[model samples]
Target: MMLELLSPLPASLNLGLVLLSALTSGLSAAAGIGGGTLLIMAMAQVMPATALIPVHGMVQLGSNGGRAAMTWRHLDRGLLAAFLPGVVLGALVAAWLLVRLPAGVLELCIAAFVLYSCWGPGWPQRLLGRGGTLLAGALTTFLSSLVGATGPLVAAFVKQHFAERLPRVATFAACMTLQHLTKAFVFGVAGFVFRDWFGLMLAMVAAGVVGTWLGLRLLHRLSDQRFDTLFKWMLTLLALRLIWLGVKRLGGA
Candidate 1:
């Protein structure tokens, strides 16, 4: 079933989409942003709405999984351990709600929540304790499943905790991979077919690997302050985009 849809796409188009998705994924990874948001938006226009979440999840699972594997040595095991259960629980709840809920409203809510988390006040900074990490994991994972990706939100939380650059990026990727993996499994059980899209998925994965390698190389050259500044502005812009999307949906509704 999934294969039939993929088989119709021209080889060139498949390759092109994969390369494009990969570049974005790499940039997102380098900046500690999740790539799923962009992938979902792009795929949403072309694929059935029902399939977009699962497909995006599978592709991101591959992309983030690769990034996590490459940077495994730098992962913060303590943080990962603390956050995993919350993320899993969030993903499960999100999966159950995916089909029944209004996705537009969900996305809007996610966008608003992320905006608050990123720029609301000094509260987030002050609240940056053990409890915050667990809450961030659960909330971000749940919202991520609903909206496709909220990398900037997760990145913001990570930056608040980890002062170092490399460990922060690696740790965020690991956490995101876990989230994406959970999303993929949930969507699979919900009846999103993957076998049919295997070829397309593979191409996207290959491109993502190359892009991640390039991004990692670039990461090594960036200064801590520079990365921090870049991340702040990028997240601000992402917040605005989400807000705009929400407004658009509201107007349409």
Candidate 2:
């Protein structure tokens, strides 16, 4: 019984995933935008799609939640206050819909979202506390449930609210932590049976903790300007790759 929970994948692949989780957590912790997307993409290479989304949600909940704790003092309290209710509403909607997106459509949407995050015009940000925050929360979470990682969507909103590196990184961490938690909870209530992947998730999360710590140390040393520039370009390239993948998948289909 104890071993059955972890047998769905070979031991080596499971361990590799655990290591990748740590590395990506560190990446996101330091970079504030790429970790979840990278983590999910890597897992998709070796895991069944059915097991990937919810398990990724659980791992990210741990990773971002850890970063949030470490950066607690830098969090934007007002943003969080407004965003929470919206995510709750979004989670409820997901629970009600429970729809699975076709692979091609999902790839296209994610690619579009990533591109927008990289080069989109700035938001007023002040409006975020108004209906904007609620809408952002609802739409992003809804899309996240379908697509596995909404880091770019969340990062786009977070960027509008912050210019400094630490504050942006910190607040994004909190918002993602909340979003992933909601996603995991929705999956649980929807009968995803997390127990099957629980052991692997725990191992990944434990590794993520170490990665987060190291990432924070690196983040503190980077200049705000340099961080922002790297973030924009890296995400842009990643988005382009996603678009290419989507096009190829569509062509093949």
Candidate 3:
């Protein structure tokens, strides 16, 4: 049954993705960021751009949903409430503007956004609270519909509101869960055939659940100060690779 379910993809690729989902979800669970960014980049290598964003959104919905559930006690309800309206607006706008874009252009866009989020200056303080979160929710979710990952930007913005690690991580996960949920709805309305990819997405999400559990445990054990440098450099490398892939695709075309 399992083999037949995964028949659309080579067994090796299916298994690899399952493991990658676990690792990335765990990374996000522990570090409060990076998992979605890494997972999408890895998927970009094997998946078509047309299918990439929607599939990625569903997988992340499961991953972030799991993290949010695990850390439910730490969620900041006010921030989440502030952010919800913007998510709805973003989803509406994304649905109206949805169009098929070339893979290379999409890849370059994702790479550019990832790079900017990594090194960009902090958002102005005026934009850090309820007002900022509303804007961030709209902008990030809009971009997420196009690109697949905006966790870094969302994380940075969310960070400004909390000092303690658990609250930060929990709230961020909750925010992402809302965003990805909307993304999934938008993609479905836009005519993406999610059923074709359901088996793989389910497997990946299950793995992400395990990773999220392990990651929450690790979060309690590790210090945020230690991951700062490594996190930045790793994202930079991944973004650079996406840039190369984008250029290569454009050149070939």
Clash tally for model 3? 0
- Candidate that beats the other on TM-score, 1 or 3, i.e. the better one: 3
Model 1 lDDT at residue 190: 74
Pick by lDDT: 2 or 3, better one = 3
> Number of backbone collisions per candidate, in order?
3, 0, 0
Alpha-carbon shift of residue 111 in model 2 (angstroms)? 4.6
At residue 233, what lDDT does model 1 achieve?
62
Candidate 1 structure quality by residue, lDDT tens digits, 184-203: 76777677677777778777
- Distance from true location, Cα of 243 in model 2, Å: 7.3
- Looking at model 1, residue 66 earns an lDDT score of 83
Residue 97 local lDDT, model 1: 78
Q: In candidate 3, what residue range of length 10 has the lowest lDDT sum?
A: 1-10
Q: How good is model 2 by TM-score?
A: 0.82
- Tell me each candidate's TM-score: 0.77, 0.82, 0.93
Q: Which stretches of candidate 1 lie over 4 Å from their true place?
A: 1-13, 103-123, 222-253
Q: If the candidates were sorted by their TM-score against the true structure, best first, what order would they fall in?
A: 3, 2, 1
